[model samples]
Target: MNRTNSSKSIRLLNYIEEKGNKLPHPVTIFILFTFIVIVLSHILYVMGTSVTFEGVNNETMETEMLTVEAVSLLVPEGIAYMFSNVVSNFTSFVALGPVLVAMLGVGVAEKSGYISALMTNTVTKAPKRFVTPIVVLMGVLSNVAASVGYVVLVPLGAIIFLGFNRHPLAGLSAAFAGVAGGYSANLVLGTNDPLLSGISTEAAKILDAGYVVNPTDNWFYMFASTFLIVILGTLITDKLIEPKLGKFVPTEPMGNQNNEVSAIEKKGLFWANISILLTILAIAILVVPENGPLRGEGGSIITSPFMSSIIFLMMVIFLIPGVVYGVVTKTVKNDKDIANLMTSSLETMAGFIVLIFFAAQFVALFNYTNLGTIIAVKGADLLQAIQLDGVLLLVALIIITTIINIFIAADSAKWAIMAPVFVPMFMQMGIAPEVTQVAYRIGDASTNIVSPLMPFFPLVVAFAQRYGKQNGVGTVISLMLPYSIMFLVCWTIFFVIWYLLGIPVGPGTNLNY
Candidate 1:
């Protein structure tokens, strides 16, 4: 029986890998999706199908009923939109800017040998037992630093594992799972907290005029989830994902591999630390005053200009340390060397740049057709009439949310569309809005690893290709499947058990209002 079970497990994984690999290239997939969106848009428009829901109006900043009708791309106006918006879409796509800019800094760090030296030192000097857990922990905590996980930590993970003489793809999978799959679960409150909570509050207001949801309302559950993700990511990497990757032999140079830090490298690390400190000090000076340039109106951190420019800040954070390290190690002798390093880094993004162009169009096309919003509205409507109660109802909500998330990649947007319907419906049934929001979060985060529509999905693919040039969408997805399944199952169970015991989901937030 034991052998049979093991065989079945191997078969299941192989099947997943086979199916995933069978799919076309990530860029081709995006192009195909865009084509499908166009056809579906025409069909739905011909049928005169549409869905309207209450959404927070961006211009008015108030809850208003919003209607989305399918648009036929065959129509003149639709064609015009497609043509006119293509450039804008590619230029303004959310993921494109952050990923490219962040990579600019990381590229500098990588090419300058700072990242390699750091990882090598960490591998040799740090205790082996703690390395995997530490990597997972960093990935989880990266949420607080915004999109750092996608552009920075994921690749660094591969490098770190490579330094340890382990399979680099396995490390990449672990970090991606924690960073992307476990995105919604964190030990502390961050920008997303307010974004989702604000939407939940607006939805709750449809039932109660003065309902308010704070950012930290999900802190306790999320704190627990942080540890859960770390443990799960570590285990999945060590026990499952790594074993599947087997042995990897690196094809590229990974800097000085003496396995011992040279005196110059040690000096470089010291200067890098100083550079990081100086960067932080400069940022603090910019944001600490009431009238500072980085402070938002009324001095709110969440709304601050500093928060808005986090990507740029991250670039500085990485670039300074990298240049200092390079100079100290004599790898960078002049300004031309730094410029050449950054240029070399950009060259590596040729494949990624091509991929993002199509991805941008696909995401724009989906939104243009309004299919994502319509589907989410219809899905929420279906769940509302199911008449579930108590823990079962929450489970249903999570499942539905997860399904919707596979299509609608934007967290706040999905919640905005669904919240008006479900939040009010749940409140009418004696459930709290906070509880509903928490459930939606679980579904939202768990599937990020598998969703091709996610803005950063292509970027992760690019990261993976740096190590295993042949690795594709299938490889990354197969690696992350366990983490997704395990996190969703375990997180939902934790929520259900906590609910049964009448535990507060957050501060003064109960299962029911």
Candidate 2:
């Protein structure tokens, strides 16, 4: 009986995988869903219904438009207004701009062989056992470059792991865990931080008329999360993941790959390090003293001009050193090469450009329908009705988000859908949007390594296939199951502890309202 049940479960899983693989590309699916949402919203708007959440109270009696077209359509007035202003929604275009710029710089770093060379050299120098954790950490840090971590680091993890005497799939799992599972825990704010903040601000306005959630609201929490993720990720890889693949020898003879820094490379790296240090010193000198040019009148980092342009500073930090390395190593011949490198970076952002276009349209349509607002309001009412406490509420949210992540896959899209509802609800219940955002982030990130729908999941499969052709989605998922489960458990525990201690998650951010 047990064998029969196991066989049935395996067959069901196989059927699901087969169907999912045959489905439309995620970008296409987004476009189709956006169109459906827009059409339904417009139809509902034409009918007499109280689609606007703000005006929906018990005293409000929604008129039933008796006409067949109106009754069938169920359109609301505010939705029509929203549909009319589709072109005016700045959120659609503005959200994608930073990602484009960040990706451009990253493309240069990747296409010019800088990323590959750095990874190869690092792996060669490190001991075989340390490669997995280092790759995971690198994947976590690569969030600075936007989606480059998925494109570059995930595959490299498998390769670097194979270079050692370990299971390459385990290496891929570690990297994916860091890159996707810990995506929201970057030390520095990225394009996502602002986008989510904007959504939260809009949501919060429903409850607190003048409330504004800053883009950097969760920065401090995320900074601490970076360390938490690193330590947890390292422990999982070393203790659980590596041990499971017992005594598996590599199919191919290990190549004597030399990644050592030669005298010239060492000298170039030294100068690069010095240049970065000098750059930091210059910035410190400008900002540290009272009445310094970069400092605001308040002499606070939040109010300072230097802090405002931190991303550009990051670009300079990476670009200057990369250039110095290129010149010293003779990889970059002239200014023309530098221009080409930057331009090349922009070129590789084509996929992101396409994805963002659809994503923008979908978000705009969701807003136009007023469905997001109504859902948020209703959800808030239901949670209040239940009268759950803060900790339970957070746990419930994490569970809901994790389940949604399994099917939805896209972090930005899921957050865009969820933030409008939860942010305001939590704020009204005496919780900060930053706290809610952190919870959402943890849930969204923890499942990415195990979710087959993630865009990079197939790529990781291919990387694993290099060693064993039998490696597929199931294989990768099975390998990563431990990391995903451990991350979800340990990371949630850490968040609960942090909440209990009443530690500020970010700068000028609090756990409570």
Candidate 3:
């Protein structure tokens, strides 16, 4: 009976995967969406579609009646606007520059062996009983370097478990949970923070033109979530997954695989740590002093240069430690090596750049047509009429995002499409864009483990195959499903409690705008 149910579940997931892959590429979808929006704007304009709401005049600071009407792009003026703004739209995309700048520094750390060494040093040195939590914790932290966790820690987890004579699959599951499932939770800011926040900020401008969603808006919640994930992942592995997987017997000879940190690498890590402390100290000096340059008017830190320069500061934080580690280990011999590493990092962003081109056009046109505002106003009205405000509203967003995530796996792409509508709509219902953004992240991170369409899902399956020839994608999914479900359930509850308690999600951020 159990075998039959498992077979049915696998078949269903396989069907979903098959259909999802058949969908057009995200870039192509955006292009189609842009065309559709153009045609829809014309139709809606002819149909007299518009919405009236009270809005504040930014320049005059006065309350006034605002009517948003659909504007068609088929006219000569519309066509001219589209052609003239194409380059500017892509260049001015809020999510593009910060992510690219941050990635350059991340590339340095990842390429210079700093991130890998740090992950290895932490995981390999832990005691037997504590290794699982340490592995999970490293997985959660490894995301600050972006996608490095997927390639490095996922497989390293299996080796660690095998070394301890435990079920290697369990270790793989635990690590996979942390890397993919805990993706949104990190102790430090990464490329994703700026990317998602930028999108949310643009979305917020549909209603509040001057509103700015900081990259650190969700930092407080995500920082705490890191521990929640570590704890939940650790328990699921030891209590449920390891016991269910039973015992593993190696069929082949285990060869020597050096997983230990070398003496020189340790020395390099020491200097890297010192560099990080120095960086933090330098930043503190600029922000902590009453007359500091980074301090805002009246000694306010929130509205200061330090807050505005977070993206650049994040880059420097990673850049300095990476360079220090590289020089200490001779991995970076000179400025030329550093330049090459930065170039290598940017090369990985080629696909993202292409996607952003079409995405920018779609977002720019969507806003220009006033379709987003119209939709948001009407949608907010509907949600409020149905009493889906406050906690219920957030929970609904989480569930909706979770389902959509199975088909569309890119976080930025999904958020770009959803934010323009949901962020403004939620804001209308007295919810902050920051709260909406975090809810979307919970949904996005939860089902990543079970989503076959996720880019790394196939890679995880391949890793599992190393343990047993019979292991396949189903095995990996089944192993991780527990973690995914638990993360979704417990993480959502944690967020709800945080919201009810009226705790700020980040520095100076509130649940209500």
**How well does each candidate superpose onto the true structure, as a TM-score?**
0.65, 0.82, 0.97
> Cα lDDT of all candidates, in order?
0.74, 0.68, 0.90
* Among all candidates shown, the one with the greatest lDDT: 3
What are the candidates' C-alpha RMSDs? 7.9, 5.8, 1.6
After superposing candidate 2 on the true structure, give the runs of residues whose Cα lies further than 4 Å from its correct spot.
Answer: 1-16, 22-94, 119-123, 127-132, 150-152, 155-164, 190-195, 198-215, 252-267, 365-370
Number of clashes recorded per candidate: 0, 10, 0
After superposing all C-alphas onto the true structure, candidate 3 shows an RMSD in angstroms of 1.6
lDDT computed for candidate 2: 0.68
lDDT for each residue of candidate 3 in 1-513, tens digit (9 for 90 to 100):
012226776778778888999988889889999999999988998898999987655676676888788888987878888999999999999999999999988899899999999999989889999999998988888878878999999999998998898888888999999999999999988788999999999899888888999999999999999999999999999998898878887667657746898998999999998999999999999989999999999999899998999999999999999999999999999999999999998998898899988999999999989889999889888987888759999999999999999998989889989998999888878899999999999999999999988988989989888887777877887788789899999999999999999999999998996
* Per-residue accuracy of model 1 over 212-246 as CA lDDT, tens digit each: 77666788888888888888888888997787777
CA shift of 258, model 3, Å: 2.8
